[model samples]
Target: MQTKDHKVLVANRGEIAIRIVQACRKLGLAFTCVYTAEDAASGHVRIARELGGDKSLYRVSSYHDANELMAVADDAGATAVHPGYGFFAEDYRFARRVSQRDRKLIFIGPSWRVIRELGDKINTKRLARSLGVPTVPGSDRPIYDEMEAEKVAQSLFEFQEQQGIRKPLVLVKASAGGGGMGIEEVYDIDLFRSVYRRIRNYALRQFKDEGVLIEQRIRDFNHLEVQVVSDRSGRNPVHFGTRNCSIQSTGLQKRIEIAPGFDPSSIEYGFDAAQVLRDITQHSLAMARKVGYDNVGTWEWIVTRDGRPFLMEVNTRIQVENGVSATIARVRGQKGVDIIAEQIRIGLGEPLGYGQEDITFEGVGIEYRLIAEDPDNRFTPWVGRVDGFGWPERPWLAMHTHVPSDDPYDIPTEFDPNLALAIIWGKDLAEARERGVEFLDTLVLEGANNAGEPLRSNVRFLRDNTGRILKF
Candidate 1:
C-alpha cells in the first residue's frame, strides 16, 4: 500500500545503486542516491537523477558513513532507505539508525537483530546446526588461544587422512569478516599458531572482533546457494531454486548460473542434480523459517565429494548474482518479484506479493562480473579511460555498469570497483553458455593501458573455464 507514495533513498554505490533506481521507476516511486567522491561521474550517479533520484540531494558521494547517509535521507524527505548490498547493508548499527523515529524512515532490509545474528559466523553456524541443518565440521566454539588452534588443526589433519585427502587444508575465519577478509588458510599443521595469531591480529584490525574459528577446507567442493524472500507478515518464505557458483580462484565469485549447470565437467561435486535442487533449497528455507528469519536473504552452502551439503553462511541482502532470481522468476510465470522492491514492501509492512506455490522456474541465467583488472598482472587494477566500449545487441542481456567516457572514474588497486556486470538468460545452461561466450567476445574495453592492449580483461577466462568449472 505504501509502494507508490514513498520516496526511497538508494544508499550505496556502483551497479547496485543504479539497480535500485530502476526498481523505483518501475514502482512509480521517487528515489534518492548517495555516492562517494570517487564515484562522482559514474553512470549510476549520473543516470539516477534521470531515473528518479532528487537531483538536489543526489550529488554527495559519502556512502560508507552511516550518519551522513541518514542525514541525506532526512534532508531529501525520503520515506525509506535501501542500502544496496554493501557498505552497511549488513551493519546492525546502520540498520538501527535508519529505524530511528525522528528519521521516520523504513530500513529496507532484515531487522537489525537479524543482521546482527547473521553477521556473527559463530552464532549463525550454531543456529544452522541447531535446526538439524548440516554444516562443515569445525570447532563448536571460538578458538580463544593458541592451544585450541593447534587442537583444531590436528583434528582437521585426521579428517583429511580419513577422507584420503592429501593435505589437511583448513580455513581460520573471523566471526565478523566478509568479502573473504578475516580468513587464513593453513596447509601445514606446524604453522597453525602463527597463522592463528596473524588472523586474530587482522580480525582485530578490520572487524574489531577477536573471535576466530576453523573449519575443514574441502578441496573438491561445489559452492551452491538458495535465494530466499521473507515478508514481515510471517508468511512462509518463497525460494528460487539453487545456483552453481563453484567457479572461483579464491572466494571471489567470477561467474554464476542457475540450476542444472551445463557440462558436468564444470561442476566439481558429486551430487544428483534433481534431488539437490529440492533438498538444499528446502534445507535452507526450513532452517531460516525455524529461526523466524524476517527478510529477503541468501543462504549459502558447500557440497562435498560425497554429495553431502553443508551450510556455509547467510548473506542478509541482495547479491550481485540476483539476476538469476529475476530470470528464474520470468520462467516460473511469476512477475513483480523484483527482490529489491519486495524488500521495500516488507519494510513498509506489506506481505510478499506471491506464495511459494505461485512460482515455477523454467530457465537458466548466467552472470559474469566484469571488472577493470589485469588478470595477467596479478589481477592488479587497471586505471584509465574507456577508449572503446562495446556490448551485444539483445533483449535478454542485462548490463549493470558505472564507467563513462565523458567523465570516467579510476579503478583503485586498494579496493574492488566491481564496475560492471553481464547477466544473460537462456532456456538451458548450454544455450546460456553459448550466448554468454558469444556475447563476451563482442565486449571490447579498449584504450585503458599505455600499451594499447584491450582493457586487460577476464572475458576469455570465463569462456575458457565454462566446462571446466561444472560439478563432476
Candidate 2:
C-alpha cells in the first residue's frame, strides 16, 4: 500500500511524462503533469487526463524553465517530483533545490551529491579511477584556457610515449555537459586548437562552462551502456545488462540506439554477454551501496576493438530508451515498468509489489527518435502542428507522440511539426531492425517542411551500419 500522501508531480513533458504518469496510476497515487504553453495539448497531457488526472496542470514557457516547474510541483500537492531524462535530468542544483523543500521531493535517481560530483568530466574520470574502473587516459584536471589545454595536450602526448601507445587521439569535453554536445575529438595539436575554440563557444553558449576536459579517444569503439537501479539503503545496486549504442549519428539528432547488438550464435549458451552483463550489474549495485544511489541510472562505457571496456559516465535517471527496454522485457513475461513502480513504492515506505528478478530481460528492442527537425538545415528545431500520424500493423511496436490528434499543432509552414518516436521490439535483433525500418517508412508525416528525406536518411544510416560496429 502507498503512504497516505502519495501524490506525484512529473516535472517533464512528452513520452517521458506519460511513462511516469502510468507508473503513478498503477500505484493508486495521484499523478500530475506539467507542460509548456505550446505543449499544453500534448499527448502527455492527454494521457494524464484520460487516466483521470485533474486540470490542476501547470504550464511553463519552455523545457528549461526549472523554477517554474518546481512551482508547479509545489502547487499540485506533489509529495515527490520525478524529472525524466533530458532537460534537468543532470542538473545538480535543481535536484538540491527540490530536496531542500523537504516535501519528499524525490529526485528519483542518484543523490544530488553524486550528480554534482560526476556531472563534471574531470571529476568523473577521477571517480572512475578510484572505483577501479578503467578510464580513458587524459588530463587529471580541468583545462581552463588555451595555454592550459595545450599544456595538458603535451603531457598527454608524453604519457602516451611512456605507455608506448601510438596516435593518441584526444576528446575535448565541457566540464558540465552531456547529450553528445560540447565534445570534440582532436587528432593533432592544430586540430585540438581549432576544435577547442569552436567547442568552447558552443559549451559556453549551452552550459556557460568554458572549462574543457581532454581524454584519449579509443578507436573502433562500441558505445555500450549498463542500466543500474539502486535503493536508498545503498546496500544492493543492480546492473540491467548492456545496450549497443554504436549506431552513430543516425541524423535528426538521434545519436545511435541499437541494443543487444551481439550475435546470439556468438554468445556462448550461459556464459556470454549475459554473464558480463550480470557482473556489470552487480558492480553498479555495489557502487550504489557505497554512495547511496537511488532509483534507476546508467553506466556508459566505450568498448575498444580489443574488448577493453572504459567507463565514460553515469546517468542518474530513466533514459530515453526506457520504453524500448521495457517493451523487450514484456515480451519475455517480465514487467519492467512494474519494477520501476515497485522501486518508487518501496522508497516511499509502501509495500513493494514486485522483486527485481520479476523483471527479466528478453528478446531485442530498437528505439528510434523521430523529431521534426531539418537535418539538411543543421538539425534545426522544427516547430508547428502535427497534421496526421498513424501506424501499420506491428505487434512488437509502440508509438509515442507529443502532438495532439484533432487539435493538430499549427506548423510554421517551414518545418515538420511532429516530434515523435517509434520503439520496436522483436524476438531477436534482426527482426527488430527490419521492423524498425518499416516503421520509419510507414511514418506519414504531413507538414509544410519536407522532413521525409531527412527521416529517410536517418533510417538508412541505421540500416547500413547494422553489422559494422564503429565509433561515430
Candidate 3:
C-alpha cells in the first residue's frame, strides 16, 4: 500500500553486508555502504560499488557512530538503512535515530518501539509468555543479587527434576545479549556468587545493561530457528522453512543445515521430528502475527533430545544464515526469493505480495562457515595473504567470501578470522550431506600460513565431520 522507490544504505560489513549488496542490485534499488577505514580494501567495499552502489562518504569513519551514519544517509540521499546483524543491528538507540522525526529514513528491521520492548530479554520473555509462546523454565523476574539468583536456581533445579533432566544447567545470562556474549552457567550452588558477579560484570561492560535472568539450560538441546518475512500490512507474514544450527561447539556456530537438518539420527528420538517442526513453525508464525511484526526476523528456539521445542528469542533483523533460506527457496523452485530485498520493500510500505499458502520448500540446504582458523591445533586463527584458493565449479554450490577471484592467487586477507561461507542444496538430507563432502573436498586453500608452519583451514574439519555435523 505504501510503496516508494527506495535507496538503501548497508550499515555493516563483511559477508552479511555483501549479501545485502547483491540483493540491492538484483532488485534494482540504489545502495550505499558504510565501512571502517581498516576495511577500506575489503571485498565488500569494491563489489557493492561495482553493482551501482554509492561511493563511500568521506565523512563517516566509525561504523557504530549513529550520528555519523545518519549524516551519511542524509548525504547519500538514502531512503532506508539495513543494519546487517551485529554492531548497530540490534541497537535500539540506532533504530530510534534512524527513524527520528526529521529524516524519512526507514529502519529496515523492527520498529524502534518493538525493538525497545523485545531487545531486552526480560521484556521479550514476558511478551512471549503472554502470547502463549513456550519458554524455558526459569524465573520471571530478573535475578539481581546472590539471594535472588540462588532462589531462582533452586526453582530451576526443581523444575528440571520434575522434567527428569539431570544436568546442573542453571544459567544466568544477560538480558540484552546476543552473538554468544554475556552468559554464564552455574554448576555449583556454592559458586553461585562468583559466577553471578562475573556474569553481571561482563553483561554491564558488554551490553551496558546488568540485567540478567536465570534459565534452565536444555541439555543436549539442538538449536533451531524459523525464518519469517512480513510486510507493512502485516496480513501476509510467511515462514521460509526452518534451520538447524546444532552443529556448534563451545557456544560458537560452526555449521548450519536447513529444512529439517541433515541428521537422520534425530528422527530416532521419542517424539516425532515432524511434530517438533510443526509446533515450532506454528508458534513462530503465531508470535509474529500477534505482534503485527513487519520486515524480516527469525524465531529462535532450543529443542531437547525428546523433540520438545521452546522459544528462545526473536532476532529482529536479517540473519547471517539467511542465505540458506534463499537457496532452499530456489531449490524448491520458488524464484526471486531475496529476503533483504523484501525487507527493504516492506520498510518502504509494500505488501508481502503473497501469503503463507504461496510459499513452499522441499529440500535441504546447509551452510558451512569457513573460519580462517585451523581445525587442528585448537582452532587457532590462521589469517594472512591467501597464496591460492578455489572451490568446486558448481552453480548449485553457493559460496560467500572474500577469498577467491579471477586470479586465485590474488586473494587478499584482512585477518578478520571469519573468512568465508559455503552453502549447498540437495533434494534430501542424504544428498545434502554427500554434496557437503564434495564441496569440502573440492575446496583448495593452498596458502602458506601466517605463522608459515602449514596451511590451515576448516575445510578439513568439515570434511571429517561429515556424518556427525549435527553434534559438532
> Which candidate leads the pack in TM-score?
1
- In order of appearance, the predictions have TM-scores of 0.90, 0.84, 0.89
> What C-alpha lDDT do the candidate models reach, one value each?
0.73, 0.65, 0.73
Each model's Cα RMSD: 3.0, 4.2, 3.3
**Backbone collisions counted per model:** 11, 6, 1
Better by lDDT, candidate 2 or 1: 1
Q: Model 3, stretches more than 4 Å misplaced?
A: 1-4, 53-59, 139-147, 174-177, 203-213, 261-269, 330-333, 374-380, 404-416, 448-450, 469-472
Clash pairs, candidate 2, are 234-289, 237-285, 239-281, 385-409, 385-410, 385-411
Look at candidate 3 and give me any clashing residue pairs: 2-349
Candidate 1 wrongly placed segments (more than 4 Å): 53-61, 139-147, 162-164, 173-176, 200-213, 259-270, 331-337, 405-409, 412-414, 450-454
Candidate 3, residue 52: Cα displacement in angstroms equals 3.5
> In candidate 1, what are the lDDT values of residues 1-472, reduced to their tens digit?
4578988888877778888888877778888877666766667767775665444245563567777877788888888888888778888888887786575778888888888888777788888878788877787567778787788888888988897887668888775666656667888887888888888888888767777888888877778889888887545787866777887635454444555432343443455666666788888888668767778888988877677788888898888787667775742475445777666677667777668887776666787877666655655556666656667678778788776644445664445746677877767667777888888888876656556555666666677776554545
